[model samples]
Target: MVEDETDQVTLDLEQFEETKKEDTKPTLGDIFTDRVESLMKHRDIDNVLDDQQHILNNLEMMNEKLKFLNLISQSRYEASVTAFRFHMRLLSGVKKDLDSVFRRIRTLKTKLGVQYPEIMAEVQDKYTVHVSDDDDDE
Candidate 1:
């Protein structure tokens, strides 16, 4: 009777072991395929980063423009004076940029003249007066 009971117990343990394997873990190939799918995405991650940088640059420009509006809103006097002053400042910046560009062109012309004097003979300083630094005194 005892021997028969021991044999039955071993058979039951074997059946349990077979049932346990049905709820198996994922294989290495399954994990590797999932990783490969992520790596093979249609859009690269850099595109998202570039989009964010563009948005930030635009937002920074808008913020600078809005600062003028905020300053004018807080003033007790009429906004025309403040606005005119701001416009003058903006014009001054434009003049400075134009002056720098003119200087750069002059430098480039000089460099070119050193190499080939004949090419710069007709290239006169037409924009020099407009971009003069005298206006900055006011």
Candidate 2:
């Protein structure tokens, strides 16, 4: 009977060990959860470096764009203004030349009128031109 009791105790110890092992063993879900927790706790340096590189590239592109805009504002705008001023001066000189030409033509006509008064009167009577307001009843 004593030997039977010792065997019974040995059997109970074996069963307890099996139950303890079953309770402590990790499942697939437990392992996945532990990995995710570990990853969350750790900081990855490569991602931070990538983000910094992106910011630097964006700033460089913006700097190049600003340089192009400055070129247009400085050289192109100043050149346009200078060209406009030159054209205006040229137009003014042309106007002065045209005025002098018209004055010379008027003086020549007066001299011809003074030389032949009777012939000018005959031509004027034949032409019969008039300047009217109301556009000739258009």
Leading candidate by TM-score: 2
lDDT of candidate model 1 versus the reference: 0.81
| lDDT of candidate 2 over 1-138, digit per residue (tens) | 999999999999999989987889888998999888777644555677789999999999999999999998999889999999999999999989998999998797688879998987887788867868957532
Clashing pairs in 2: none
Off-target runs (Cα >4 Å) in candidate 1 are 1-77, 122-138
Give the best candidate by lDDT: 2
The sequence of per-residue lDDT tens digits that candidate 1 reaches over residues 10-107 is 99999897887667776899789889878876476578778999999999999998998778776745577788899999999999999899999879
5 Cα displacement, candidate 2 (Å): 52
Clashing pairs in 1: none
Q: TM-score for all predictions?
A: 0.33, 0.45
